[model samples]
Target: MDFYLTALLQGLCFSGIALGIYISMKIFNIPDITTDGSYTLGGVVTAILLTRHLPGYVVLPAVLIAGGLSGAITGIIHTKLKINPLLAGILVMTALYSVNLTLMGRSNLPLIGTSSVFTFVQLVNNPNQNTFLILGLIVMAITLLIGYLLKTDFGIAMRATGNSESMVRSLGVNIDRMKIIGLALANALTAVSGYLITQFQGFTDINMGIGVVIIGLGSVIIAEVLIGWLNITSVWISLALVLAGAVIFQLVLAFTLNIGVDANLLKLATAVFVLLIVSLPRLLQVKD
Candidate 1:
């Protein structure tokens, strides 16, 4: 039970990244790779500020700004300088390694005695339970915000830009600007994931975000599969499923570990699971 609970907490921690990927990949069709770096950037910023006894509220905005800046840089390169989106994201993600290391002044920082966002939620004696509550609220707020944004005129334009760039541009919308803003929002949410994870886990490591994009991709794919099967058309329900998808992904992983899979092979197993998720629909369609 505890094991599953931990995975649930982890899923909530990663819910933001899943949503970030949804925006950039699902909505905008931009394969932004800045998620890896921006994730670590959030953790690094959170750890440094928490160590300074700063409030969680104060630390959060800083992480968001940092992540937004990283995404915006990729956007500028892709839109203005004509660099490929993938390469621009790669460049920014690469540079963020040094930035994160410099911020931490080391490869990892432990928050053994530090007070975090969960510190205030004293209703639960179990720390993990507290984490669940805190992260739950955060993810809920973000989901609603994203849903609201998608319903707005500008949000509809953004979606149009993603679906048919030429058509949106013909409508007098600045496609490049939309791309930039979209990427910025995507990465900012990714950073929020990092922030919550760092606080929950009580530490920040430089490599904590390595290959994290795969995890986000897996969660979104899970949501996609469910949304299709259920024919869920409500924006709010769709967003909620995305969050549930994150939890389900983590729960699946935890169940695998509990079944006596070797810890060292976890990444390989994760890759296999993601690949299956990616290919199953096609395989089933072919069967038809």
Candidate 2:
């Protein structure tokens, strides 16, 4: 039971990245691969700063800003330079590899003695409350803010831009700006998630972000499947479902581990799971 709860909580800590994926893929209709790099960028920056004894609050905003900046560069390349979105994301992600390494001054950063928000929470009260409670609150706050933003006029413009860039341009909306905003915001959330995960896990590896985008997409698909994907009537519910799905997916993996499944094959399992979920709707329609 403890193991189950721990995995669920750990899954929640990374839920922000899942929400970020939802924005990029579902909301913006863009397959952003830059998340893999930006996730490490956040973790590296936060870990480096924490190692220098910087305040945890300051590190959080810095990591978020760095992620946003990296995303903005990708958006500029895609929207302004007329590059393909996928290529732009790839280029930016590749560039971020060097940047993250430079930030860490090596291939990894360890937070052996540093104080993080989670540590502070542990100090303030029940040292036994678990790091997940703090992470859960942060995730809830981010989910609420994103949900509220998606309901506003600007959010409508963002959705319109995603649905039809040419139409948004014809209506005199700055399509480039909207794209930049959406990508930046999406990656900022991803970076924050990365920072939290590094703190929670006590280390950051440069290679830790590899395949992160795939996992995030898998989480979104799993959530949509579990929720029936029919009444995606509001952004809040969508975000909530994504988080829930990620936790459930982790639980499944934990169960597999318990059954002596080889961890080396987890990526294959994740891919198959995503494929199944993504195809379910069309398959059901055909059956009907």
Please state the error at residue 283 of candidate 1 in Å: 1.4
lDDT of 1 by residue, 139-185 (tens): 88999899999999999999999899999999999999999999999
- lDDT computed for candidate 2: 0.85
Candidate 2 residue-wise lDDT, 1-288, digit = tens: 877876787688678788888888888898998999999999998888999998877898998899999888989999999999999999999999998888778898789888888877663465436576787788888888888888899998888888998898899999889889889998998898789889878999999899888768878888777667566766677788999877877787777777787989888877777788789988988999
The parts of candidate 2 lying over 4 Å away from their true place are 123-128, 226-230
> All models: lDDT?
0.92, 0.85
Top candidate on lDDT is 1
What number of clashing residue pairs does each candidate have, in the order they appear?
Answer: 0, 0
Give every collision pair in model 1. Answer: none
Error of 2 at 142 (Å): 0.4
Query: Which regions of candidate 1 deviate over 4 angstroms?
Result: none
Q: Estimate each model's TM-score.
A: 0.97, 0.94
